[model samples]
Target chain A: MLKPEILDPQGQAVQRALPRLGFEGVSDVRQGKRFELEVDGPVDDAALARIHDLAESFLANTVIEDFTVKVEEMVGEEK
Target chain B: MLKPEILDPQGQAVQRALPRLGFEGVSDVRQGKRFELEVDGPVDDAALARIHDLAESFLANTVIEDFTVKVEEMVGEEK
Candidate 1:
């Protein structure tokens, strides 16, 4: 998630612009990014730890954003 | 959220690059955007429906991506 201050401008812009498009009652609109990871094997502790590191170093800009990493198991499905 | 095929390339790149950094067990990584909206008043049906439309027309690229809009109530806090 984007830091509140960092995200405020975009939110404010959305809030201001939407009413013209017939959308009212919308105040704050903060935007950020999400990453969904599919693991090759069981997402054990070791894998989670690596993912956490990757999230901190690669996926998220920790300086101005906060991110959550979740591991979803593909149960009998191909993607 | 980005359509699976649209997000696949970035996911594959991350998967390939991370292992070289000594991180394994990660197969797929799909990335997309998140928007957090703070409304001015009670978020009723009317507000939600407007948000849905805003999401469709402005926030997401409907032709190639999917998006979800959620309203978060700010309780006893100033932002």
Candidate 2:
């Protein structure tokens, strides 16, 4: 779950023009990314490392964009 | 980037009640994850591998939720 923040110039531009678009009460509008993947069962340290590699290589651009990742089991699997 | 897809029960719950929220013309409301990070000059494949680890460890929950990653350089830096 890596999220790269580009200058949401498009989102900002839309946000700015939103008022004219007849949209009111909208505060901020930032664009982001999302992903979902499957592991064998539970993820371990090594598996985590692999996921991060994907984030850096394909998920986010380190130069200007920053990203974050999150992990959890399938829904209802938790007690 | 890796994007994990959870049931989005919350989002669905909200979507179900959106009509009552007086927010018409809106179609869907789904939640996602986004990240931004920096690398040396440009990111290599190895770096990416590490990032995915972070995402899996902390950023997302595989149980009921899934996520994705994205990488990109800062804006205007590209020539």
Candidate 3:
């Protein structure tokens, strides 16, 4: 399980501007996490399906954000 | 590229105790990051080899710490 750093530049901008917007004392609002998973597979169609589930069930905060999965064929193999 | 939250629990514990050691204003010493990559492959021997490279060259801060990789056969896929 991996959670990425919560440094939202957009959030920070909003946080800084909030006092002007009549809000204060709202400190330490950080960003969410990002997780990368390396699953062992030829990464066929079914494997892709599971990667989706892994993110939905355990990896991401669906309500707050979304994620993407990239399938890279490890860089030193043939076919 | 996923950079995990820098929350060093051990660091936090040490930070809290620092005042006793005459340390002051030493704030914002955070932890490093964690990245999990899902490479597309049957994750054969060669694939594992590349995953190691991905982490060392791009994913991790080799000078500061180390990371561990787990190869989960994407759940729901057959061998």
Candidate 4:
């Protein structure tokens, strides 16, 4: 996500339009991206660290954005 | 998030590129969006319901995407 101090024009536009669409009471809005990754092996601490590194290096642009990575779920055959 | 059955070309491109970038073990990738909205007053169940309705009607297209809404944090004077 973009840093808290950075300007978020996209979020600002959404916030302004929300009340116009009759969904009132929202004073502020922020937007971010979510990525879901399926790993071939178990998600250990080291694996989590690697994902964090990947997020910092490849997924998110460190100059303008900050990111957090976590395990969402472990998929079985359904995945 | 895009429905499971939907084809995600963007995520597919990322999954294919990750290996080239030396980030291994990720077999698949799916991408979605995150929106954080700040309510003017308290975030009770009624407010949450309103947000969900907004998400369904305005934020996400129910035919292709699904959305989930929850409170992340409550702001004080810093907000």
Instruction: By TM-score, rank the candidates, best first.
Output: 4, 1, 2, 3
Worst 10 residues of 3 chain A by lDDT: A28-37
Q: Assess the local accuracy of residue B76 in candidate 2 as a C-alpha lDDT between 0 and 100.
A: 68
* Candidate scoring better on lDDT of 1 and 3: 1
| lDDT tens digits, residue span B12-56, model 1 | 787788888877777677777778777777678987887788889
Compose the digit string of candidate 2's lDDT tens values, residues A1-69. 212344567546645664565444435455555544444544778667766765566545677665566
Ranking by DockQ: 4, 1, 2, 3
Docking quality category of candidate 2 according to DockQ thresholds: incorrect
lDDT of each: 0.77, 0.53, 0.51, 0.88
* lDDT agreement of model 4 with the native: 0.88
Q: Note the DockQ of each predicted structure.
A: 0.74, 0.08, 0.03, 0.84
Candidate with maximal DockQ: 4
lDDT of 2 by residue, B20-56 (tens): 6443332444555554444444456765665566556
TM-score winner, 1 or 2: 1
Residue pairs in collision within model 1: A1-A66
Highest-scoring model, TM-score: 4
For A1-79, candidate 1 gives per-residue lDDT tens digits of 8876574676677778888888777666777788888877767898788789889999899999977776555557866
| DockQ, Cα level, model 3 | 0.03
